[model samples]
Target: MAEFFDNYGALLAQGTIDTLVMTIASCIFAYVIGLPLGIWFAVTAPGGLKPNTAVNTVLGWIINIGRSIPFIILLVAIIPFTRLVVGTSLGVPGAVVPLTVAAAPFVARIVEQSLAEVDKDLIEAAHSFGSSNAQIVVKVLLKESLPSLVRGAAITFVNLFGYSAMAGTVGAGGLGDIAIRYGYQRFQGDVMLAAVILCVVLVQVFQSLGDWLARSIDKR
Candidate 1:
């Protein structure tokens, strides 16, 4: 055990940094793109406040196509785009491009679903008080749906965490890369074990924090 730690401790630390960078960066991009798209989706669906079938259909199809592609294929297929965005398709930064693309649709879907869960009565009440569509959405739908949105964000974050590790397969430089190179290729069981344990711990921490935040925000 001591020998194992001595050999791979530095690599493990680096892996943690890589994983954190990839996950956080991708989540930020996902939220920036996804939240607006989700709001649009919610507001344009059938019977929605702005109900535009054509726009919603096209946007939904695009998001669905993006979500359907497996992450591994996405990583390889978007190499050119990734390179154009980050100048390389194999480091933590480069990995963010694909990870964000892959995560956006998921985040949008989650956000839309959370918004959909908002009580229709609340929206009606806002409308009855002469609130504009934008006001109703901003003050009624989003505010009431905050807790669910937080939970969705938590789920997205965890999913992105796993994807970041997988991105290491293409030299994205995370715990996954470390495990693949030193553990699998070099037959270092200790390295693999440590990486897996670290991932588990990270997920647990995220889950706990998410639950706490969601509960705190859930005034209803």
Candidate 2:
């Protein structure tokens, strides 16, 4: 046990840190793009506040196309773009670009779904009170969907966590990189096992925290 720790502990610790950093950074950027797009989706759908079939259909197709691509393929396909964005596709910053690109469409779908679940009555009441479209979106739809959004964030984090691992294939640096270089290539079963365990622990911890937060914030 002590020998194992002595040999791989530091490496594992660094890998864990890198994984967390990549996942978190990707999640934030994905949200920055996805949140507004999602609101647009909900607001312009057929029955929404400002329904526009043309805009909604076009946006839907675009997001669908983005979501259809596999993460590994997206990782390689966007190498040039990723490098352009972050100056190199080789570490946490590199991994973040593809992760965000891959996750943003997904995050947008989640947000649209959450907002769709908002009470129609509330929206109508807000309208009767002469609230602007922007006010209703900010105060009613978003506020009411806060809990669901938190849960969606957890799901997005977990998905990005997996994608970050795949980014390790291109030297993006994370537990997945360590597992591939040492555990798989070097035939170190114990190292692979340790890395897998840590990933599982992280997923469980974050998912639980997200659920708790969602429950705490839910008013309805």
Q: TM-score for each prediction?
A: 0.96, 0.98
**Model 2 lDDT, residue 194, Cα:** 93
Question: Which residue pairs overlap in candidate 2's backbone?
Answer: none
Ten contiguous residues with the weakest lDDT in model 2? 169-178
Error of 2 at 22 (Å): 0.2
lDDT of 2 by residue, 56-118 (tens): 999999899999999999999999999899999887888899999999999999999999999
Q: What does the lDDT come to for candidate 2? A: 0.93
In order, the Cα lDDT scores of the candidates are: 0.90, 0.93
Pairing residues by index, what is the TM-score of model 1?
Answer: 0.96
Q: Which residue pairs collide, candidate 1?
A: none
Could you tell me how far off, in angstroms, the CA of residue 176 lies in candidate 1 after the best superposition? 1.6
- How well is each residue in 4-115 modelled by candidate 1, as lDDT tens digits? 7788888899899889999999999999999999999999999788999999999899899999999999999999999898898877878999999999999999999999
Best by lDDT: 2
